[model samples]
Target: TLADAIFRHLDHGAAAGPSLAGRHALVTAGPTHEPIDPVRYLANRSSGRQGYAIAAALAARGARVTLVSGPVDLPPPPGIDVRRVETATQMLAACRAALPCDIAVCTAAVADWHVANPTDRKMKKAPGATAPVLTLAPNPDILAHLAAAGPARPALVVGFAAETHDLERYAAAKRVAKGCDWIVANDVRPETGIMGGAENEIVLISADGSERWPRLTKEAVAQRLAQRIAEYFSPDRSPA
Candidate 1:
């Protein structure tokens, strides 16, 4: 298989350093669109840049990457298997299909709820007419599903928490609630321009404690994360 061939080449030619040569990584990125009607849907400001960068970085470290992405304008990263999805349910399914992976990173800004009964046609707004009521239901939690204890669960699971206030507290709580190994939390307040922006400021919360990272380009963050992942998997290194 092409994937096997690529890993074989990586394993043979890699320099003396941390290498994921034959590891598999599953990553989810972008914002899910929950349909309200045929023409309208709920979404957020995720550009998928950070997710894409992470996928690329992992691949650079010799991990075979499967990027499950939501609708976004960015081109697919080279040497990656990209699975495009439109809704949270679809994203979850895609993630499940890429199972038995070594690492799982849930970075997509999936909507928490979706319209339970979305109309097939475009909803029209008529003058002096009552607005149509949309029944709402919770979307499937992809991070929790991936982090759940099971034979198929990845060795490492990371979740992202984009928040407005009390970032660290909320992120720490989320890590436990979702059963993920780490939570990368960021302030998404409009003024911060972190969401849909080129740079990010994050606090990486894990059982060991929180590590505050200075604001840096998404690519830099991805590289740092990929390095950390490699270190975590290194045979000589102790578990964090």
Candidate 2:
């Protein structure tokens, strides 16, 4: 990026994490936009605060960050390269283009389906129009794709579960099916208000077991998650 080029004359570089130095990290953010017409799109209530915070935390910990993001109104974090995309397919392409990263954080609330054939022209309602039918197709699961990247897979692939209920059980099932190294599960029920809120609570599920964390600020969540990632990759890291 032109902004990153400003520090071209840098030496070894001053960074926060020594262990994660020289590692490449990829993070996807926001909801996928499945277009129904030229003007309308399908998406979710994701402010991208959580994903952005995670990316910033990882970058601060010395990893080269590539944020593959969907359309959102938030500002990109500093010292990180941003790849803007609208749909899940575009986001997947961006991730593929920047493959073999050391870590991948699948944080984007990607849509599971898209309009099978979206009209290029603006869809109009006739004078007595009732409703328009849209055929839907499944969007590629970005997390599953990254986890099964085969040769170019990241060392650590983490997936997120935004379920309305049975968070742990559902997340575990997704973890096994998606092939991710870890799964961060959260309950997004109406009462949780975690969809587009400032605070979050989650449980990290891995091969060893599950670790529960209390509700905290988004920044605090990022910091704690980053620390867990650091420890997991540490030479002497151990399961808690």
Name model 2 segments beyond 4 Å from true. Answer: 1-18
Q: Candidate 2 at 201: error in angstroms?
A: 0.4
lDDT of 1 by residue, 1-240 (tens): 999999897764343358888999999999999998878998877999999999988888889999999999999998999999999999999998999899999899999999999988989989999988878899999999999999999999999999999999999999999999989999999999988899999999999999999999998898888888888899986444
Candidate 2 local lDDT, 1-240, one digit each (tens): 865665652322333343566889999988889998889988876888899998888876777899999988889898899999999899999999988798999899999999998988999889998888888899998999999948888999999999997889999999999999999998889798888899999999998889999999887788777777776677888663
Model 1 poorest ten-residue lDDT run: 9-18
Worst 10 residues of 2 by lDDT: 9-18
Q: After superposing candidate 1 on the true structure, give the runs of residues whose Cα lies further than 4 Å from its correct spot.
A: 1-16, 238-240
Clashes of 2: 0
TM-score of each: 0.92, 0.91
